[model samples]
Target: MRPKMEFDPLAFFTPSLKEDSVFIQDDSLSVKAHVQIAIHQSVTSERVTSWHDDSCDECEEEEDALMPLHILDLPMLRLQPPYPVLVTILKLLSPDEVLNFEPSNRQQNANPDEEAIFREKAISSIHLKNALTWLNNSCPRLNASAKLSLVPHLSLALRANFTNEYNAYMTRIVSNELSWMSEAEKEEVQSLASMRISENCGRMAQPQLKRKIHLANLEKYGREYIYLNEPSMTNDNLGLKTWGSSLILGSRLLRVSTGSPFLKEPVLELGSGTGLVGMCCCLMGMVTTLTDLPQIVPNLQTNLKLNNLENYSCAELDWSAPGSSPVYGKSFSTVVVSDPVYSSQHPHWVVNMISLFLNDDINNNSVLIEVPLRPSFENERQLLWKLMSDQFVEVESEIEDGYDDFGEMKFCYKRFIRKI
Candidate 1:
């Protein structure tokens, strides 16, 4: 028979996380310690020593405290997108049975029998209130149409006593980013305001140009990312949206056959759209700088904070204005580029930027670039290959498939070491 487990007070309870460090909390006593649970293995011993040094007697009865414990990584707490989750949540909150939000087949895949239980849980006043608060604060950079469409559903949810919160959020939206929305868009919103709330409840499709997509690298690093993307029509710069090559490049960079070069070097990523690849480098314990055009810098910065990765930084670097001086200083050991070759002129501009920013210590430094194969940029692709190969030898090359802004496109990644 297996030995019965005993309740151990010093069994390493979950320490409260404040930023990067961890702390212990009791009813009347709160102690902050430098011992990080995730990074350190001997947390209990360290905690005992730390508490003793700090003169705490809560667990002093036990001299040698030991417990079979594993400090597990915390699961990421992410906001569910407002479309389906919020829509169903709102329907559950409304007292009036005007709208019937039957679960879609995809939603039923989780557990068909627990629909009532899920609905009851969703209707909890606290959950509903918290959901609204999160939506107001952490809402993605959505376009006017998407924002306007949610008004009806939001109205139904706020029908009880939460109108003030809804009104405040709407006012802020209108006065802030939506202020410059076209006159037609304002009229469209006004028209929708009077429409039946039930009909619009099910019309929750995200527009093509302004979809919020999440890309995951959980296998490489332990986290996934959320990115707000605008199609080429909405934003002139394609860097506003994430491309498939960034994923390919990110995975390739993390799963390199050689030693983890990223861990040893200061890395710079050019054309870092949504900063997915660069952020992955940071997750792998490298100091990564994500750079793009000035317009895309703010959004990239927002993404960094959204993912709780403010340790990584962002900068503005236009390849067209490739300057003589190193933009991010002169010490970047690895330079990464994802889908940077688009137009014919891009090859020269991008290569020049790489040459300027990438370190000259050929033996120790390298350039990692992933370029998609597009028929329109065939000549430009050849030019980029020629220019990079002349100055840098291809230490590692991978011809892989990835999606571009338009969808799946074949891509090739090359790790280049400057020729001796």
Candidate 2:
């Protein structure tokens, strides 16, 4: 068997990895370049000790906030056109037209020679009502996206007759309710319209953008993550967003997995929202089941499908009503949960669920938990630790500095074995 390699968390933000450190390909990730970033949680004893960077956590966060984003790697985040796609897009342009590859200009002025093709067609919309249809037909998708982004072309079509095209499209959007557009984009368009009208559309105030779409960008895991943040879904919709506690815990598990004794057979993750920690377990070849409340289960299953883990499992398990689940009586050697303590009742409920599902054994079974130290939840956090200590011996506890979309936070993770 090939020996496991040690990865220093500090080295991740650097420009390059050590050449001497041999890298191997994993099928979980689409490419090796993606291996540098992972977000999830799991941990046990062994080589997982170096996760803390008390003196330098700030520096690391500054360098790799939330996730390490580099300007050259914007394609990975789906922000910029990838080089390969750019090459394909460039083919749509004419040979003599010389569209400078610059991005900031929006469009370049067309030379006299470049206007020859449009001149023959005599660009103009039939009328204001059919402007979008004309634009759709006139502009080929690839050509418009890649080539011929010239002011003269738009000026020719929209200059005299098509000047009303902008207002026409605006009216259609407001009346039709463009659901396809993001909440943020639609809100921006509404703001623009209000400025033009000098008042609200009809109501005293316009609706705000509450829904957010997050792209996890897991090229490292060869997994696709499409998450929706709809706070309006429920009061306890915390499952919608992936938290940093999960990332910190997952990173620790990844770092120590080679010799870690923590990952016992048939791992079960409780409160597995968005299922990042569960995905980490599955990637490690552990038999894993990701569980959450009934409402959150659909997103969990969707994430599983996106990550190419159809063969794995996700189930609905409410901590408050543990026995209501078919899995309530089942036993797992390792049980994990992160950021589960939110409400006052959560401390007792989470501990109760862990005890019920985790196998009763003196030496073999373990429970891993990670939770952020939110200022509001200090009392609950303290109560949770006290309750946990009553039934399990705390093998290791560490505070990790972490960052998520909400920003930087301090998280405490604990490793536990059943008390004899």
Candidate 3:
């Protein structure tokens, strides 16, 4: 018999919070607008500096006024407590009871105190202790940081509770990095950063040369192509690593005969983890842009430069953001994504991103997606294909078996064009 897995408190807490978290991520415009209005009201005619300029007293005062608003806007901020608070709450939790609390439990509860009690107690678990230890050690050594992201919040909490100067410094660095700077400028700020590998997840830190390469042979083109990507942090974001479905998708795209739409048109890839599929498209003579979150952009840029592909470029694209105002403009006739569906909101967000970015040329526009069949993600996976079918008509599709993070798995590859 397969060994039983231990109950994970984080996992138990995640589903309950994910919908609200996604809500916050997608609707952050309201929060930003509120902060801007507050700043204008409070700091009329005050001397200001660029957000990255910390030495200016005026800038520091402006930030002090803004920080509280920023923290208050986070949908699940209250759920995230300082380490001491987390431990105390954990000590009071009954793991079995906490795990069993359903969404309906909230509706049935007449007393608000009961709900608060459950939320506080939910943090206690052996899994959380291990995760906390990892975070405590990893935060200081992290090569990059950003505000409004989880890491900085955790660092700030630690600083407040333990008064650790390093944590305080990390929080500041992340905020600086979030300032308005060109991607090139951002790279300069992180140039001195040295990344450390996570012992548990096999993730390599920045400035580390530990590289893994995956190659795909294109017999039709009489050559082979290579891709390089390093392992990512243990956080669920898989963009830092390359998966087998991506390699398979790359190979399949390369093997397609000449005069295909991909060969002649500009293509944009969403959630371009490791840039494997996009790099392959570039090799096949297509202009391509590979996009992901800001944290993953530096490493993705490194991989593109590693292969000496000039036709391909990297951009920061957050799918949860309003796609109509994408950081990178909408200019591509084709969009591609591989293994992107994961959370409850991912299907809607990913499809919405495609709709916003894809050109309106009906005969020429297309989208190709490769999905690994994982039982855990079955519901969301079905939702993705269903949503795609509603918005676009299927042009062609295929299914195959391959190796994924979970070992051997079956994968579906589908190509679609806009519905009339």
lDDT for 38 in candidate 1 is 29
Candidate 2 local Cα displacement, residue 255, angstroms = 1.8
lDDT of each prediction vs. the true structure? Answer: 0.51, 0.51, 0.52
Candidate 1 lDDT, 1-420, residue by residue in tens: 212223222221223232223332221222222333222211211121133334656644422221111111101123323333243333332322211121122112211233353343244444444544555555432112223222222222222123334334333333432343356644443333222232222122112232333344444555543344332323244566666778787766666532465334678889998787887777776778888877778878877776676446788777776452236455678888887876557788888877778778755688888877765567778999899977778888878876532334578888887778
Query: 249 in model 3: Cα distance from truth in Å?
Result: 0.7
What candidate 2 gets wrong by more than 4 Å, as runs, is 1-233
| TM-score of candidate 3 on Cα atoms, chains taken together | 0.50
> What ranking emerges by TM-score with the best candidate at the front?
1, 2, 3
Clash pairs of candidate 3?
90-124, 195-205, 195-206, 196-205
**Which candidate leads in lDDT?**
3
TM-score on alpha carbons, each prediction: 0.52, 0.52, 0.50
Better of 1 and 3 by lDDT: 3
- Model 2 residue 162 CA deviation in Å: 28
Candidate 3 residue lDDT tens string, 85-169: 2232223211111111111222232222433543443433453544345434433222111121222212222222232332233
Model 3, stretches more than 4 Å misplaced? 1-216, 219-225, 231-234, 322-328
| Better structure of 2 and 3 per lDDT | 3
Per-residue lDDT over 83-182 for candidate 2, one digit per residue giving the tens place of the 0 to 100 score:
2232221221112221111111113233324334334223222222232233334423322321232332322122122224333433443454435446
